[model samples]
Target: MHKLLPALLLAAAAALPVHAALPVADSQGEPLPTLAPMLEQTVPAVVNIFTRTRVPVQQNPLLADPFFRRFFDAPQQPRERIAQSLGSGVVMDAAKGYVVTNHHVINGADEISVHLADGRTLQAELVGSDPETDVAVVKVAAEKLSALQLADSDQLRVGDFVVAIGNPFGLGQTVTSGIVSAVGRSGLGIEGYEDFIQTDASINPGNSGGALVNLRGELVGINTAILSQSGGNVGIGFAIPINMAKEIMAQLVEHGEVRRGVLGAQAQDLTPELAQAFDLNAQRGAVVTQVTAGSPADKAGLKSGDIITHLNGRPVRDATDVRNVIGLLRIGQNVEMQVMRNGKPRTLNAMVEQPRATTVNGDKLHPRFAGAIIGDIVEGMPFYGKIEGVVVLEAEPGSPAWRSGLRKGDVIVQANRQDVADLASLRKVVRPNSPLLLNVQRREGALFILLQ
Candidate 1:
């Protein structure tokens, strides 16, 4: 696409004004092809957003201890200050003044307001938001408003002409034009579920939650992030495809959160090295690294060493794609998957289920597991190779476990110098009135704690 795209873009740019009326002049008196007609329909739908948030400053952990805290006047709950941010939004429903933007734009906002193309500003009430997809919806009380048309993002193709409308660098409303550089771009670490529409459009810091539209003045994507080392646009920008945003918006609007199905499996990308080692013809697929026993995948006969090639007939590009497809599926829905086993493709069926929290009775493991649900890594709880230990599924705030310095994601590897490999062994070791010693490990690292 590298060489072919430039020629196509040049042809498209050359043909832009020949179909329409003659040239015109802008405020600077420079001869410019009239984009006013197109911008008129879309620019009004794009609104400026300002938000104010109050966040507490983090305090040192030592200051939280009773004895250490007594050394000083209990440090008043971390001081909070108002943080203000600005962005852009697209009005999707004119009658209701429903505006869609990135979740991060309105997250933790104490107050949100929308400034229209005219000299009017209205307070906006957050309707819903989904952090996983970084999409959000907010509504304003208004009667006569302009809304943009939403195009089927799935129909967008590479090199398609597109424009980004937003307040770049807080310079009011600005429009930049570029062609779609790529599609289905994933593994960018921008959001939990990423199926982005890549474009060369000039998106900047304040452009978050703005609109990315096509020639027909149809909303196709939401301007999100740009790949830049100097924090400036480098002709590489990303947008949340409107189709994915639409689906997430619907669930957020109705349920106030997104509910995704669990596959009970951990997978890795199908790299060229692994693909060759597995003797597969194509190098694009997700390889199962681990599958929990009796899980949805296991009940469907999936096992380690299976390469997932497709999900519900859609070709799986990598582990992220597999996750994207499954995470969007409704719970209890039957999922059809295609896998390559022994160099041959086979079909497997499974019912998408929500991962159940498996726990053991922690009454006896008081002060450590008391008021907490403890469990072994059995079904779909994230575990690395050869990691065997009891995990705390849930812990009450200020509970015995929390007081004893055990966190929710921490894995208890050793207790009282004894390796607590499983629940039975952990139960056998923890005793009452004994000085407790615990070795906990998280993604950050491991530490040893002594509890009296």
Candidate 2:
């Protein structure tokens, strides 16, 4: 009877005329809660992004053979095809027609078009993009565009109600509701700098670069990646905080690239054994391991054995936290770090420094390395302080180094079966006329290249 009474009451309430005003309850004593009002103002700001990319078509190895090509009279020019993909973006500045989206959305794109909720499609120009943070900005010439207000994402709590607005599966401006699952998520390997705001907000493939807003219709995050094995939404999703995105966007707009600052030190996560060694009771921090001489860290009096607890007033949980915080700051910015030296808390101020890589021509090292440029691994670079090796900064196409399977961004960790930690060590191992062997660390994996 109780269930039936509730159903009857619900049916009676349904029969009542719907009012424009919505609250927890109406004047007739009926419960009615809705997200319609908030979504009405937020959806228009979210745009649909379509990209067309021209990519080379792969051919069989036999087809590339000179003998086979001569016999079969294969086409001289390479075959190409156009690939199309869809994603979402947010209208950050309606006046300037600036739309912010994920870098992967328009990466390698030949043409980009933005579709508005008002049935308008405008061509967009790439303003700039930072692949490390996966943040990109595009400009479109449009009118009457709506923009969402940016909210303080740092103030967001785990239980705060949030809404995800995007064009999911090309369905056009879909809205999903969820609460903040977590904040300050890092070490995901999804991006170089990952301080993601994790949420269970049904973020899917086409939802990338969409807007994640709070209940007040204010933007808190930009939906970026999902953690689903089946490519479907399994409730686990991640977004770049608007605060972080805003900084990256500013640098991209100003310099067309991110000039990341460095702390010039290496640190590892604080372990229980290390905590005991340092006589510290807490486990959440990063222990400094090395400080480069004449660097910002060295100038600021940072030393090995110091455990960093906080940066710029925020708690540092591990090495990744330290990396992400410093990676986002621009050059010449001031940083405040709180560390424990000799079991005593100490505060230090340091200015972020511009990173410089010591580069050398490959011809000076070996004949096979001609036309390649090798550089010392500097702070703020990938694998900096994590690996000891010289990096191939550039390798010209059709050059001796390129023919020897050496490409740019390859870290040569070993030469002639001997450890080559830096350029000087590499020079000691490689003889001019002797056969050369290199153990290189590529982006995907490691391999050995032998040159005669």
Candidate 3:
């Protein structure tokens, strides 16, 4: 791509039409191609965002200890200090004063201020934010704002010319130009939900939540992160597609949260060896590994070993694709899936369902479980739809459960040496005034948490 850029630039130059009115021109007295025309229409929509948050200050272990603090007459209240940061945002609705930005920019912010291109600064409030997708919406009560038109990011292709507008490193309103390097990029581990548009645009510090626009000055993506080891732009940057952000923004504006649904199926990437073992000719798909009983997948007659080729009209390239598509859908929405079963293609339909939240008070179960909140595994929880078990929703600090090594998000799969899949099974295994034995799964590994 590095070598190809010069040729692309030359091709672009040759394709441009000359005009005498523009300031930039060729040696022959004709105007040269320039982005000034598009940028003039879009730059006002991009904004500089400043935020302040109050966070607890880390102290020494002795200061944290109650006995040591009492001996020295230290302050009982934890010390808090204000943190400040800067980023960018795009004004999506001029009339309503709606601005969209990255979740990380305003997360935990105590005060938010939006600075417009015209030098007006207004106080802002967070509408909603989704950390998994790293998208957020803020609302400011202001008039005469400029909003950028949204483009269909799905139509974007590799080599498409793009412009990044943001406030980089507190330098007000910087613009960078580059080509779309790739699309539909995932598995980057940068965000929990990712379908990024990879570009060579020079996204840098304070560029988060900026606008990535096309030649027509239409918003195509939101600048989110850059891939660099030295914390500088190295011709590799990522942006969340506007389509996905639009969806999340709507949900955030309406419900103050994203109501994501589940398909109740676990799948793995369809590898060459696995395809050969299954006697299939497929080159790209996700092989179904498990389907929960009574789930939408099971009710729709989806079975294990089925290879998913497409979801709705989108192609499934791997297991990540399958997960990404389903995770963005709203509850109660109908889904159509194309799968290959036994070397033949088939179509199945299922309605997305909301995961149930069944929780139990820990103190009611046993003395050892006091001060903890246990619940059934649901969507957004670790290992949801992949494992059947109970998860610790909350474990109060300095409590019995916390002292006994129990914490939030710990999936308890076994209790008293018996398989405990849900709250009922756990209840049946628990005994009053007895030591509790729990086989727990925490993120990537499993361990035993004993509460005596």
Candidate 4:
């Protein structure tokens, strides 16, 4: 009976048709498709950008000719110093000959050249660049060229597959595949308005301004930066989302500049300690550190220490999140903001205003206080101590503080025999004709002080 049962099972197995393993769909239940069609459609739009810049050479004082010293009093002679750099760009409009790239790629370049994938090389002229967003647009004199189509980057999600194409390390036309690591990542200090798409793609130096496309061959991001210690790809790469790039590109093409709305407020991230201290249920949102007087935020009744958690009903996870939303808004547009103050949440409407066009020349200014230069004692800073007094950042080289043996990072707790809590109090106590007596708190211990 057992032999008869085994024979029946074998006959049943033989009756079934032969089967082979087949590829299945992804987690979204979408079937996997060949990437060849996407790549074939997009690769032609990508171009390599080569730039040459001339910099002034600093001549050595020892190499100066004694005979020519009288005629040339200048310390250095101007010389043609050429610097070469490489990056990648994508053609946005073939008819208008417009190409988009990172501002850092072509900044200060005297000559720029674009190399197409089909062995065609063209000289490119810079139209405009916005260093705040790290975006730039260049123009070439060619029609009928391949151009790329932009996709809505706001629809992207984490774990979505993406492909990066660019010239990495001067190697032409390279491609790398990776998944979206994160979205709306900021505070990396990479750019002014950082709403970056974090990815694990192999992006290197020359890959900046290249294309980060989805499986549909649509441009979703522009490769901008990488977080690496060895100056090589370690999988942590960042890209400017296409939506932000498109907004800047349109402005650059039309007016040669980007105009961003500002609320005129200094913001800081809400730490877990601050969240607990303020009785916040969630450790999210940005806290207003300072509101500029007579600005949009001030006019809207936003004050310092107020925690902003939402804008237009959308969650503002941090200061960068608020900045990203405000920067994209147009001037005169009214936006709703939800703020938490004194353990209570409230909503306020604020009209966006134009940002100040002050040109910052990268100078570190020292605040003058009571005949001394002072700086704030920022929290969590690895400085001398945790006292609430202004530190002597600088001392006017040979001022009273310098002569009194007061050095930089010396925290001044008291001035004019009165307790000093901040720079404003220090300034008030240090009048021009008043006798200065400061009690300083050094790195070691507190010390009584007397300044002239």
lDDT (Cα, 0-100) at 137 in candidate 2: 97
Q: Which stretches of candidate 3 lie over 4 Å from their true place?
A: 1-23, 58-78, 365-372, 380-382, 385-390, 395-452
Per-model TM values vs. the true structure: 0.73, 0.87, 0.82, 0.68
Candidates 1 and 3: which is better by TM-score? 3
TM-score winner: 2
RMSD of 3: 9.0
lDDT tens digits, residue span 176-275, model 2:
9999999989877788788899999889989999999999999999999999889999999999999999998889888888999888899999999999
Residue 145 in model 1: lDDT: 92
Query: Which residue pairs show collisions in model 2?
Result: none
Q: Stretches of candidate 1 above 4 Å error?
A: 1-34, 56-80, 358-452
Local accuracy of candidate 4 as per-residue lDDT tens digits, 303-416: 999999999888888877777788767678888999999998889889988754322110122222324556665421223123567777655545555656677667878876
Better of 2 and 4 by TM-score: 2
TM-score between candidate 2 and the true structure: 0.87
Quantify all predictions' global Cα lDDT against the true fold: 0.85, 0.92, 0.92, 0.82
* Per-residue lDDT of candidate 1, residues 1-452 (tens digit): 79999999999999887668644777899988656789988899999999999987776788767787778767655667789999999998889788999999999899999999886899999998987788999999997799989999989999999999998877899999999999999867677688999999899988999999999999999998899999999999999999888887777777777777787887889999999999988889999999988789999999899999999898898887877787777679888999999999899999989766557755566555677788875433335333778887777777776777777767888988899877888878887667778888865589986766
lDDT value, candidate 3, whole model: 0.92
Better of 3 and 4 by TM-score: 3
Ranking by lDDT: 2, 3, 1, 4
Candidate 4 TM-score over all chains jointly? 0.68
